[model samples]
Target: MSLARFLIVLWVCLVSAALPLNAQQQTEQNQPMQLMDGPMDNMLPIEGQRFRIDADIEEITLLFFREPNSQPLILIKPDGSKWYDSDYPLERVTWYTDPNFDMIKIVDPEPGPWQVAGRVDKQNKAIIVSEVRFEAEPLPKQLFQNERLKVEGTLYNGTTPVSTARFRETVVLDVLFVSSNNPDFDNFGADPTRVAEFSDNGQGHDEQAGDGVFTGRFALDVVPGEYLPTYQLETPLYERSFEDEAVVVEHQPVTIDFQLAEERGADNGIEVSLDEKLVNPSSVAINGSVSYPNGEERRFSVTKIDSFPHVIPLDNLAYGKHLVELTVFATSNQGREFELQFNNLSFISVEPVAEPTAEELAQQARQEAVRKAELERQQREAEEQQLIVNLIIVAAVNVVLIAGAISFVWWRRRSKRLNNDPATAQKNAEKAEQKAQKKAQKKAAKSE
Candidate 1:
């Protein structure tokens, strides 16, 4: 091959080899990013209101020739703005055109459309335009209500009105019954059951004309007392969910009015009963012929039950004061419930009859004494058994010591007889003479 042709072919081959290596390097770079997995993969600035825009034109070749006369006025500016001054190419075939925007830019975008087009290596591509607009309105204020409250107001996007936005309205009633200090209700020697619950029985909502006003009314079940009503507004965006100051309602009917402001907080309607003052009598007895307004008058015989707060019909007492006494006797198995007639009988105290003696005090004392003596006898016997066990242990130890002394004396006499034997004396003398000779040899070796 010719030198120039061979050099060109070698360069082409080198470029081709590098392309695959470059592509492999790119794949390795993307692998680390792929290992990261989680919801972070689909993150956006305004996640709740975000939408994806996908427009792609696949690979195609495109070519353009430079014009000699036009000189490509790359730095031309159509308006006075710096963003429009073109100091770079419109776009490169192999690269992306990034349009990074700042917060202020998004808040007030430049007026006009941005026309964008792209081409592959040598082919012409279609063009598109994107018009940018900004929405700078502040969020509307939240709304709330309490039990039996009138909600009337209009919602606005800004100074401009937003009449078409869909809105949801809900009326919730929370009736709380508070108790007083009575044994039946509270934990500290008080009653927790003394409670009263007021309900919001009436509620209505209406949409007004022209002004975009919304209003609501609630009819509260007001008892003959005072109460506290709280208000709250709960919406998705607002965390505080606006709350209103406590509104007090007296014995008479109440009317409240307020204008809806965009920044105003909603009052959470918390229907709390006021701590009530009850007139408690010093003493009340359950002793009467129980008669309901409609049901039968339950009659009690001598055997009738006599439990505290023994609830029976009190003849459906009117809105006034009446006295009734019930008579119950421990002996008379048949108890009697009487509706005392105020006009006929005089009130009298019924003292209980003294119980007759069944056994003498002296007899009870003797019985107790017998039980005491029996307990003492059992304790003494247990102690004596323990003492006997200790005595037995002591006798066993003494016998062991005496047997050991006799064995020691016999061993001493036996040892003395062996030493007195003539044969034993001869053997001992021979051993002593041999030991002396060995000791003398060791001493002589030390001197040498």
Candidate 2:
């Protein structure tokens, strides 16, 4: 009962772990990409609109949206070259225009200020510049038909995992399988050579979703051959696609012992053995050889062993890397034959160790010193620039303060002159009397 309870608990933990993966996958599939928010960097470049972009971004994706009948988006390169949607070299500059939005994809663009000019009406722009790296883990490359296969993937935006809310909306995952022997297997677009599609969903032989893992099984009844597995993971900030091949073959039921090692100078040998139950000892033979780097080939005599662990003598090898190969042919008592070749096993010869010379050590020290000096120079230059900026700010503030003080003094003197001038005071009194007399005469005329 305790063992059964333990198994039940283990099963429950597995289910619980899988539930979140499924939930996350659903969320990714269902949630609409909130393309307009979260990201603070957006630009609407109009005609003669100049903007500077960071030089570090290796790729730039420009997204433009506007109401219908707005000025068509136009951009001019820094090299005095003009670019509109439909620019040549579909790779460097890609233009996608529809009723929804106008977009462009630029790869390895020159780092500098790029100009934007064109029709501008209620225009919205989004600029996403990032470098993405993808790591794809595929199912076992050697599997028989009907065996379940799994492919897992981890996505990164720049150096960080792509879990940021900023990219969740735009990220998408696609996995495809193609046959390796197709005549036009090199080009998938032209021939549509894909044979199957895998999903992260647990159904259809897949394990779970949203856990950065995708899995799918091939048909049990499918033909045995080499198949290509491909996956594409893309987002607004990042995109990567990879394809590789896997093999399927008939299962073999036999055991072979293979070993290689050197003990001291001449005690080194290669050993291989076939199971007596599956292979008849009289018919089993091993052909082994060693090739050195200098075009010398050393072939061993045919070795036969009815029992396990047959040894082949390997001698007269100089100090270096050597390639060793083994080929085994075994026949059953009933005349069924099996051929197996194991090639390119590298064996390294021992060599005497030597200490670095004093001159070499001195050279290494100089190089390290030069590197440290360069770093110090950069730090000093940065410090000097910061100091210059601070000094300029201080000088500007002083100029402003001095000008303000001079203006205040001038105003105070002007007020004193006006208050102390007797002629000015008399002139003011006479103007008041003249204005009063004119008003009184006008009033009497109106009364009459």
Candidate 3:
């Protein structure tokens, strides 16, 4: 049968068993019998197909597992009366049937041997419920994310533990973390989460099987928030649930901060800080791999730490986005040690702006001097070219003036030679006088 169906059957059985018994019988047994001595002894041994119930039991729940499609089992009461599913007394008897099991709850049941007539499974068990309750330790007021805890609980009938080996086989113990929905907390409006199930099979966190002390290993891996823990114990015939006090699950106690290199050729710094109020700083160790932007990765471990803000230096890291993945092993102030993982931690490294060094400044100064010298040389060459052009102009002017003076002197010497020669001078004067007479003749003709 499914665990859900079993839990339903158990709940119905418990509710039916809780109904009041006969008034006279209740008055006689004013106080319920205290079965607080040892492992549950209320269950009597089965002989053949019959089991006996004691007279002290005001309510009894009997469960029988049958083969598939088998006929409904017939219950033969202590008075030799037969009771079937259709013919049980409505007020005092409740019967439930399924394909694999039949559950019967009897209130103020007759104290005697009852017989079952049908094909019953060999492993069928009879569970008696008397003041059944589930008891567990209250969760701590504060918890940390990724914390693992071992919690123990016990199923009791009055003051005695339910130690039936066969009962454990059919019982289911579960723990659920329900959000407290406090607006002031992080888990407000969060859905309920089933974190762990209790086990008694000597597995994981359980020390022994069928010892009635159920153990559950709870891993607080859910979101850090306020929650109310509920522990439930379920059996084929009854279920008991207990709600623990509210608890706040704080964030992981360790945090990581990356400080990029401030200057060229400087080492990058990773500062790991821990909450001393929650964990012991001296007991913490961090180890992880750093993936640089260039796809190169280096692994490192930090131990023997005795102070807060444990700094780890990463040298020669490239500039760009860098990924840091780490795992922290820390012991809490409460002395509970746990391991936490931090993935997806990353930071960007930018190249630093550095000032020019003295050598670089000197080189710049030398370059400037060379540039100035080149400019001066170009200016000097231009000045020399201008001086040469000025000299050529002066020389050309002086040559022209000297040539004119020579020409004037030659003309004066020629005139003097003409005067020295009479024939030449007389021929020159006659030519001048004949030219003047022709001009006079032309002027007189024009007047006429």
Candidate 4:
């Protein structure tokens, strides 16, 4: 047969043999072993094949199946005593078998292939797997790269493998870039070809399979500069990878592995962040740099402020209330002065180069008051003069009217004499004579 055909045949045989053995072992584990119909002496089934229990009349019997180099199995009694398929290792046998070939013992051991042993009590009532156990170990890390990256690994406990345990893997890249001074660095700075490719292989790593092996990769077009790559593995049962010693990817590929271990202590120092939430005009979230005494630059934020007094609502400030004096203060008080012509409907706070001089401010104030008072006094004096002029005009008009009345009287008498008919003049004289006679009579009575 061809090499491929031969390998296929070998695999099939192994699977078939292993499966039946597992089933039989499981069945024997579920019940007490009993006689199968006929009476038999020292003969029992092992992996569906017959085996002879070496006659140690003490506590247990053993079942052994050999398939190439596989570990020998031993089944034991219901009393919890152990027996080994091979006598070489005395303490290793944990499971027991009965006459009917039922399993009366069970053991929670490390993950791996297990052996079976049997025992006969004085009455042969029960059997158990009491002694040996196996253990499994974690799988090794496998790395692969395609258009993206792929990673694969298994989880095990000692020699046995655990099924269906949740595992998570994460990958992150600290991007690298070439300096402008580099010889190959072109003046045309941003080259799309040199940019890193993108990948979403679940947090920059690989896909996980039902078998607990993770496999996938991230797409990255690494630039012509230094960069770092890291991966984290986590599970409820185990923790691996030291956070401090993160994977460093400078210019080359590095193989990284992780194992579950105990947790490390956390950071102790406080973290300071800078924000620029409150600034003028365009109140926005801005990133600013904080300078240390040595001129080290760090990011920070400066929030917005109220007008006039230039007060900031520092109520929620992390460090509590603080007196932050904004220099060049202006726009308040009697001698108030501002550096710039601000026309905010509300009061605005502007940084001034220097405060207004006291003399200039006082002089301006006095001038304004004086000008207002002079305007009022002028208005009052003008009103009073107008009243006096109106009174004099009234008196002159009265005197002129009285003089005109006298002239009118003289003109009327003369005109009446000239223009009046004789009869009309005689009537007027008669009325006047009557008026005089009445007045003369009153005067004589007063004299008496």
Candidate 5:
């Protein structure tokens, strides 16, 4: 087959194998990755099959598809100078060849018609390099969790905006929040989070389609912490990434406190407080819905705040948990305005206990009086019993004393009668004299 026919068949086969039908439709516009129409039109003139390189282009790369094992490509510059594959290692030129294609890169290329003299397939492309850039607005300094922001960016090719709709379709711009690894922040060691993807499809946050301005709807719903906002632009041929300075996402600026009704059937109140250090109190506006346990919802809005700790009164309070969903719009203390969402705010309401009636109090008093009288009667009976026990003890002691005295007197009289008896006295004296004679006989025997 002819080289062009072979290249066309190969291209079709490669595309068919790589993508499904629906994806092919979506990618048809992007197939000529970074191949601008002006350059392509100027390069492919009617006179001959040659490409052009403009003077302003700092560098250009040419891709030529050829049959496997084909001879190396031959490039003819505008000055009729020829550069061969063997002429590699030359300054400002790089040539690489594979089984299917040859890629040549030239720096400061001559600005005129250039031709490839070889049996190269018709599927060739020229890419302008080192001139494509993505420029974006700097992320705000004071960002809050759950804040939605619209950031705009533009793709530039050598100071010219890449506004072609087909070219825009080939570009993918994404924003990622990579943890700054600052120990002072909450997101330290956290995985990188993709927060937004830029689009030019005139969809959410995008003002218009293919106007060259790419809009990124950033939902800062990540944990309040430090992050390095990184932007990446990717196309089928090349990719570029940029990192902005680190930013800290502050905590939500609105806090809620519920002041439930003091008594049952009374209105409940909610106190909304704003962080004055982060947000302006007067500029804060709250719009929310209260979902009650009984499946009823009430919407409220507070546009004017007369003072701090603004109170919102809630009527027909429910007896169970009530959920509060709020969207706060406020200007930061630095004058940057933003909106925040607080979905999980909630509180509970309870019923109060009732007081007793007058009749119940009177009955309690009567019961106390009867209890006091019974206690007095029981105390008197206990005192009488204790008195009788003490008297019995005293009487028993007296009887024992009287018996002891009578016994002592009778013994004394008996002793006096015995002393007056002479025979008893003489017998006592004779026993004493016998004990003394025995002691004197022992003394005399010790002397002998």
Candidate 6:
């Protein structure tokens, strides 16, 4: 057979041998391994139920169901020891929950008999995911305000991407336009008409429906401002939203990377790398410095390096919030010398730059109080429901016990009366007289 045919035959044989084993394993894993099969209304600690872990496991996850959350999982080892996460040398287990989902992971579990203390739901509804990313290919960092703007995103589940299978049906992107010139800090005032609908239905530039990539684009004409993109996947299984903080829009689109690092036992300094694509390399004049709190502006050497990234270091900066701004002067191809200013580029060293104002702190406290009150209310309601169910069960058990006791007493009295009655005495007397005659006859025979 040819090489291709031989490989195909080998694959088929391997699959045929593994099919039953794979199916059985999957079925076992999917089933809810409960400690006991009964109503989990009382929230009582159940013992005596054991489950065996016969196979190697990389992770064991418990996903909770129903809103307001339910019981916490308690695990016990085969040697009658409580299993705590801290005991494991390398534990990747996590417990996280949201409004839509709750999940916990136990990493590298030992193989043996173990017991679960809490009841698990039948349906977990945790979404399957492999990876997700937002991308920008050949799009320039700097674009004119009147040009077209495009952005792309892709969502994945394991190796396969969920494109048109979800797309507008679940995955969505909402673009927020913020005016940088006179920005509104309270309400972002994003334009509803600028919302872009992305699709991967093999239309236009899309390669395939299930290829996982989604694209959206529109003209950048709503004044010169910063545009932030947010992506949302609202599904029954999982619901989450992510904002892309790396990309933004402005007339002089500039991106900066700042880090405070100390070298050779010296004080920390801010290292910055700047990139701008709109102007000619040799013609561009860029000047910037790190402004300190004590009215000190330390400058760094700027170069016209075009091929590789040029890093500039500003040293001996003290610990505090600092602002660094760049003023770019460039001659366009049309011989126009235009100067652009990027301001409020702030960074803090050792401490946060934007500390909460007094009023803001008060507002935060109020919100936290309200949130705690609501959580307590929900917990109380859950406890109330559980108590009611437990009370009903207890009442039923008491009734059964009382009925059993009454039946036992009545049966005891009836048994006594049946055994000691008038007919019983007469039968016993006749048996005794017969026994005496038999004994006398036996005695006479022995004498003869």
Question: Which candidate number maximizes lDDT?
Answer: 3
In model 4, which range of ten residues has the least summed lDDT?
339-348
Best by the TM-score measure = 3
Residue-level lDDT of model 6, residues 1-448, one tens digit each, is 6999999999999999999999999877655444222343112122233454445555554433322355444567667677443343334656554443344456665667776554544333222232333342333434444344445666554343443243234444444443333353222454523545456667765666656667656445444445544555543334555554423344543345566643332444333333344545456656776788667887654546464244555554466778887655565454545545556777766633465889999999999999999999999999999999999999999999999999999999997887699898788889999999999999999999
Regions more than 4 Å wrong, model 4: 1-357, 365-384, 411-448
lDDT of 6: 0.54
* 442: Cα error in model 6, Å: 99
Q: Give the TM-score of each candidate.
A: 0.26, 0.29, 0.51, 0.18, 0.51, 0.26
lDDT of 2 at 407: 100
lDDT per residue for candidate 4 within 305-325, as digits (tens), equals 332222222111122111221
Q: Which stretches of candidate 1 lie over 4 Å from their true place?
A: 1-153, 160-162, 165-378, 439-448
In model 5, pairs of residues that clash are none
Better of 3 and 6 by TM-score: 3
What is the C-alpha lDDT profile of model 3 across 1-448, one tens digit per residue?
6999999999999877766556556654443232222365555333367766677878767666677678889999889999997898999988877676677889998877678888877654455556667777677787888766778888776566777665555568888899999898888898888878987888887988778888888877778899999887776656777888889899988778988787899999889888998888888888899999899999999888878887899866689988888878888788877777777889898899989999999999999999999999999999999999999999999999999999999999999998899899899899999999999999999999
- Which of the predicted structures, 2 or 4, would earn the higher TM-score when compared with the native? 2
After superposing candidate 2, which stretches have Cα over 4 Å from the reference?
Answer: 1-51, 55-59, 62-92, 97-103, 107-133, 146-150, 164-221, 232-241, 249-448
lDDT of each: 0.32, 0.59, 0.79, 0.35, 0.79, 0.54
**Residue-level error in angstroms, candidate 5, position 71:** 31
**Decreasing lDDT order of the candidates:** 3, 5, 2, 6, 4, 1
Clashes in predicted model 3: 1
| Candidate 1 overall lDDT versus native | 0.32
| lDDT measured at residue 61 in model 4 versus the true structure, 0 to 100 | 26
Summarize candidate 1's per-residue lDDT along 90-145 as a digit string, tens digits.
34222212231111111122223222122111222111111111121221121111
Q: Model 1, 191: alpha-carbon shift in Å?
A: 36
Higher-TM-score candidate of 3 and 4: 3
RMSD of 3: 21.3
